[model samples]
Target: MVLQGLTVLNQKNYEISQSIGKNLFDNINEGGFDYVISECQTCKWQIDMSSNVTCIHPLTLLCMSMDA
Candidate 1:
């Protein structure tokens, strides 16, 4: 499943962000998706840093699959 536009709260709300991040990660794992693609760089970074799932840009996926 593709999750987009995820935003991390500022430093003052770090704990809140961690809780939300954990929930997001847990949901993604439960969904059994192969990839999580997002156009937002922050979303990509967050997913990459927090989970084992492959997170990529939509354009990257399009370019890679062009020959297929």
Candidate 2:
């Protein structure tokens, strides 16, 4: 799904995905966790290419033109 020119795929907002995108959504150290997280515990990923505008679609303002 597209959001503000970024392809963010969240379950409540995406068309082909299902997730909240984060684990332990609260401050667990303060008191306790509000809910359980069941995703992979050892998975490490990165978006080095999309760190800038490299992954933005052509329909986005950054990819659009002033005269067109």
lDDT of each: 0.73, 0.26
lDDT of 1 by residue, 1-68 (tens): 33333436366655566676787888776778888888888778878777878889999889989968
Candidate maximizing TM-score: 1
Regions of candidate 2 where Cα sits further than 4 Å from its true position: 1-26, 43-68
What TM-score do all the candidates reach, one by one?
Answer: 0.68, 0.17
Off by over 4 Å in 1: 1-10
* Candidate 1 backbone collisions, by pair: none
| lDDT for model 2 | 0.26
RMSD of each: 3.7, 15.5
